[model samples]
Target: MRYLVHYVEDVTERVHAEAERARLVAALAAERGQLRAALLQAMTPMALLVGPEHRLELVNDAYKRVSGGRDVTGLTYREAFPELEGQPFFDIQDRVYATGEPWAATAVPVRYDRLGAGLEDAYFDLRYEPVRDAEGRVFALLSYGVDVTEQTRAHLAAERERQRLAAVLEHLPVGVTFAEAPAGRHSVSNPAAVAIWGVVPASPEVAAYSRDFVGFRPGPGAPGSPEEAARRIASHEWPLARALAQGEVVQDELVEIERPDGARRLVSLSAAPVRDADGRVDGALVTSVDVTERERLLAESEAARARVTAVLESIGDAFYAVDAEFRFTYVNRRAEALWQRCREDLIGRHYWSEFPAAVGSESYRMHHQVMSERRPVHYETISPLTDLWIDVSIYPEAGGGLACYFRDITARKTAEAAREAAVARAEGARAEAEQANRGKSEFLAVMSHELRTPLNAIGGYAELIELGIHGPVTEAQRTALARIQQSQRHLLGLIAGVLDYSRVEAGAVTYRLADVPVGEAVAEAEALVAPQLRAKGLGYAWSGAPPELHMRADREKLQQILLNLLGNAVKFTRPRDGVPGRIEVACTVDEERVHLHVRDTGVGIAPEQLERIFEPFVQADQRLTRAQEGVGLGLAISRDLARGMGGDLTAASVPGVGSTFSLTLPRA
Candidate 1:
């Protein structure tokens, strides 16, 4: 009973206070659970890392999705994302935790080792906030992240495109320049622009453009002065400046520029104003191409054309030109006189219309042919209007046209006609002479045949009486018979010569042609003439020819020619002053022909009479009482026979010297 009196004085109050503290603790735990649930279900990616090792203490569903649905709640940050070891995210998280400072980054790049997706690259807008305990000492890190991969990639792609366009614009061959709107301040220029201007202006304003780029409008004649030229193409007149001020496009405006180096250049400029989305002028772009060489060539071409025109006007002949359409393009002074019309009436007019009478003429046909075939032609025609002969030449030009030249040839044509008339008169006289000669040959041929019949009858009667066919004969009667018979033989020989001459003139004799050996033919002729040579006391010599040497001639005709030649040589040669005359026969051969030469040291013929001796019924000595026995037809007959056998007889002689008779024939 005494021990039970312990201090129970306020124990109930202490128990009540303890119960209130327990309720407060339970409420706080419930609220913390609700907060955790809220964090895990959030749409944003969130994670909690605790301690120095950065163990992943909590991760939301959005965070798990970003990690390729990987369960990494109990893993350290390094273990969950091993691929991000070298990334700035790992170091940044450590720094945030160590400094107990909140850190944030936009478009930060990260690499992750996802569960089934392997390694992946992602961009994010991330924030790291430090979690502190009651003492304000950092204990854990809270990571808040937003996936900005698509947005960051789009922005990067736009930046790369801008850089590529800038590279292309820098390397263009044609000069390019850009200037800001309104003020026309130079903002961008390629290397080609600087090269064209020769120098870059120190100032970027439009007013300074002409300081380095002095220019003038292209036109004839020279610019007055440098200052005047600059004023002519001031900043306001420049194509680029005009485009910026007026919002207009200017194309292919030619400008002659004077560089700072004193070199002049011609440029073709094209400019247009750059527009903003609201269709307002924003800037101006310009392109320039240098055309100095091209302009110089054009000037030279004009000068060459003028020179050609002067040459055409100064030529002697009548000249005209026609285009491909056959319309007259030019008519010279001479051409105008020849056409009997002024150049104004002929030029630019159709050729046929100007000269209608020339249609269907040879000149017209040839002109058409020259144009169609692109060839040159020359022809003669008589003008229908003037009736004068003209020699016309038409030449095709390279530039689809024709050039024509004309010369008057009426005097030449008249001379040719007169010469043709004289030739006709001479031909008629020759024809009449040939007919008279043919009649003479026919008369001699008839008389020769008729006279031989009576001469043969007389020879038969004389021979019969001498043989005592009719009665007995004495020595006187026999002597009388011999004289008559000798007279008959002489008359018959004359008739035979006449007959041969007649036959040759009428072409009635036929030759028996063969390859006759020249040596054998000469030997036979020499034997026949041996008696005559002996009688005249003349020396005769034969120059032998090769046995194989032959001539393509008639054998009988060749023998006759040699006999006549040798006989004449024997007859003419005689002893003079006790020196006997010599007759020599020689033969020579070439690759295609043979020559038989009979030379005589005798009474040689005069040069004027040599050719006459071979004419019909002609003689060197025309006296009636000539010493020669037979008619003077021997040489003539021989020459005709030689020619009939495809050979020729020619004689060369001097009055006091010897004579050479050469007979030429084809060799086999």
Candidate 2:
């Protein structure tokens, strides 16, 4: 066997290997201890041997100085040191015998009693192993230790601080997660990270977001996903990308992360390189902030740019918009065609000054209308050269000069003269007589026929359903027939309202003065509608309705109005998967008037035509005159009926979201 004898290099691994030779106790053939000693003597750490039974067999002299020069030879360890037994001193020897393998045991708190540790300032990393003779027979076990007390104490302090730091991470206001390098396993996470994970917990770990190197989800996809983003990163030779692969320190940088919430969060990630004592690369340290709200505000500012572009494209007439000098500023599709110029050519040229001959007479009136009125003004004049009849209007622009809208009306004037001559010749006397009485007589006959037909059917069905003369009705068909009967009654009320509007117009409508139970009528109407509301996923609730609320009114007419309004609210309200959409009916009283309001988050009315919505057969949506498959007479008749009962109906709306129709009546 060769003796190594001198320390020359980085000694940590060499010392550990030499220590292992003592563990091959049962497996030793011959000269194992001599061979192990030779191997250990060359380690960069100073080597030594204590006797198998606990006396110092030899020292490398480095051990003597560190151990403070105590002559340990031939002395029994447990006798000199009674504390060695409780510290598993025997197990360390026997572990070598059984497995014949070395196991590390350090920081057992051995005092350097003889080493001038008078101030209590030293510790060691001690090991025990079997020693073999030259003939490969077990002769003794060797024990050794190195002074590692300072390193051990520092490790313990660092562990304590690491645990405290992990606890503080749990209270982090923003999400924090760590991904280990190489494997990219989830090593640590804060409470905020857990919550954000729950929001879209498709996968348990954020490893899917890691780059080819050791980096977590603080990555962004600019023109794409991870693969495409990495390609861009490689093309740009990003420093973070290089550091993550090699475990180098990387400065903080912004990245894009697409969250499962379908939002883009801009994040800044910073990683610092971690290394072993030998300075070999180990891994990195990575940190994400949500910047979606800021980006959304920026996007909204861009929308205003789109609105400006839309205004420039919408003008349809033979319009000319120009600057202070009458230089053409913008021309839409038709305006470009009329000026006989391409958009590229027309945009920068002078319009009025280009044809300076035409500006003095007819063009002056067009230009004056905009500057003086500061509003759109219209006039008819012939073009000087073309002699074409032009109806022109000029609107003053916010930034500058005039925008003129003019149309040829030469044929219209000639047609008007012919019509004037024709009107002068005849027909005024005969038309006035037919227009006054004929329309009224026809409306009364239609109303009488329509109301009487439904009244007869309603009366006949009431008689039959009551007597069971039509045979036994199925439960389903009986429910249907009941709805039909209810509808017929509602139809009859509409006819009565039509008659009421006529009476009001002629100042003949009258009221039967009496106190009626308003709640009883509202309850009856609710019961009739409650079945349909339940079938169609509509919610029905009543509030501020006293059990015996009294009012001076016609009972049948008030019930009809409540039924119509509430039914409309229910029918228009849409639902999804059997869940009711919002429709609320509420009433409030302040002693003067009982305000009944039906509001719905259903289809609403447009603003322009809300004023005349109460006129007979005049619906807010005309092309959809029967869009909902209903006679539009309901609201018109309801208004007249309310006025007849000394009440009023008014509506307010926001298109697409909802409408609220209110009925205010004096209380008895």
Candidate 3:
């Protein structure tokens, strides 16, 4: 029985051992299936095993795609993918395998650029885990990763797109720039931008040909120097900078910029702020267009305006402009002179302050009326001086303004008054003279009739005596009757001279004109003045061309002019020692006219009174003691007659020296 029990125990131990072996087989198979499926689901997790290490004991199809490998069976890592053997990725895997502990890392941007242009650089998130045998020894490593190459490539592509856009903007023909909004600070710039600035030409040819700008400055009142200006620019402090910083459009803000040559250029800068998606100003886009021509035109226009102002100041008459409030807006040089006010003192002040309130009252009213009615007003008023008359006019301007013009007419007014008084005196003198002339004519007529009556009776008696109607008287008695006749004729001659003078004053002098020899006329006048010359013991001398050379003239008037001048000369001459008293009459003719001169080498005219001697009712002296004994109308009448005959009479003399009087007449 004991033997039988021992055999049973041995059998039981055998059964238990066999059952444990079966359970172990089933668990191993199930775990293998799960790991294989998991590798397929998470391909990158098993990518490590099939890498260039030829460790393909476990891996997925994803490892093949990433590695770009084909079949790797029965081959070492060198044979499978020789290029990957010494790569950085392989080195990282070796470390993971040696560590035997799980590892994961991030933060460093990954790079993988083995692909071509269409398929470029990618990134990854990698992990490695240790797989342990039942005995706790690690023989393999499990790697898990994500092929983030697409994400990395997409990010890189977006960056490239932005660069391309910037490049395109910089290379554009017109200069383009971006600055900070409200603070124009220069940021990143492209090669083309640097070239346009002339600060840093990137292209080799451009750099060689152009000068680079180290920086900009405000100088005294501008921005900063070129070097520091960049900072101010980056900060956006300039006009363009401010507008840009403020996100506003800057339109044609004229700015003076000092160029490299230390010259200023007028520039018109236009700018606007560029905003980001968040609606914040990122920078300003700007363009600067030079407008020096426009600036020059503006300066010229200003100079022309100043010239006009100067011209207005130079006119002779007072001129000024006034506002509706009677404020002086503009006053010219004459205005200031006439008002005794400074231009500065009155330009902005009331016009009434320039003159006394009591004075220019009419002018003040006219100014107001013109402005109020928008019409012109004119009047004649006494000047503020109160001694002169002025004609003043005020005209309204388009916009409630006024212009005034004034001219002084004091001389004209005085002349008019003198003319009226002279007319009154002439009328009075004419009435008195007419009454005196009537009395004289009556006396002369009665006297002539009384004297001539006796002469006629005597002449009749003589004729009867001769005819024997009565016995012939003795010869002596007949001669006595003839003497009476001659006396009567002389008296009539004196009356006729008086009547001729009166006729001239009464505007009744008659003239007969004919062609007469200038020389012959003078000889006849010398004959008439012969008696006066003989009385003064002066010689009567005549000079000129022959009588055949004639002058178209009133022959009687010419004789009268010559006789009057010669008679006056004979009257003035007095007998002197060795120097003969002489009256010289001379006449000469040219192609067109004849000149007759009456000269006296006798008592000469006084120099001081030569011109006055020609005036009627005037003589060198009023005293009756003077040798001259006739009314002072001879020269005046001669001048009048000469002018009437389209000729002129003139005289020249020296005190105590002989005088020459010339009469010019037109030729026949």
Which of the numbered candidates is closest to the native, going by highest TM-score? 1
**After superposition, candidate 3 runs with Cα above 4 Å error:** 1-252, 257-378, 381-400, 404-494, 510-553, 585-595, 606-636, 643-656, 664-668
Among all windows of ten consecutive residues in candidate 2, which has the lowest summed lDDT? 42-51
Model 3 lDDT per residue over 1-668, tens place = 45544442457877888888788878887887787788866756354354336375655667656544454434554555565544565666566667666777642244332332232334667777767678976666676677776776787789899899877876764456555433344454455444334333234433322221212323333444677666765664555645544667877665666553445656666677778899887777776655556678888999997997888877666788888877888888876776667889888787776666534477767776788789898888777644468777788877688887766678988898899999999999999998897776566456655666665676566566655577666778667756765654554444444444444544556666688877777768767777777776787667668757888788878887887777767767766777777777777778898888888766666777887877765676668797555556667777777777778898887666677889998888
Task: Note the Cα lDDT for every prediction shown.
Answer: 0.83, 0.64, 0.66
Candidates in order: C-alpha RMSD to true structure: 21.6, 26.6, 32.2
Name the top lDDT candidate. Answer: 1
| Model 2 lDDT tens row, 1-668 | 99889966888987787777655543573455675566446332233234445454554445545645655445555554454556565556666544545555667665445354543445567665666556855555555677777898898889989999887886776666554555433465566754443232235434554333233233433336677656755554343444545665655555555554556556554556556688754544444344445456667878975785576567555666777667787667665665556767767788755656577786776676577677777788887635778788787888767777776788998998899888865566557755664567458646866777869778678658745787877777777778877777766765665565555444455667566766776678888888878887676666758856677677777877788788777867786555567767787787767778888877788998778777765766777454454545667767877888888888998887778889877787
Ranking by TM-score: 1, 3, 2
The digit string of per-residue lDDT tens for model 1 on 20-73 reads: 878877886887688689889899999889987889899998999888888889
Candidate 3 structure lDDT: 0.66
Candidate 1: stretches off by over 4 Å: 1-332, 347-349, 372-379, 391-426, 472-480
Per-model tally of clashing residue pairs: 0, 4, 26
TM-scores of all models? 0.52, 0.29, 0.39
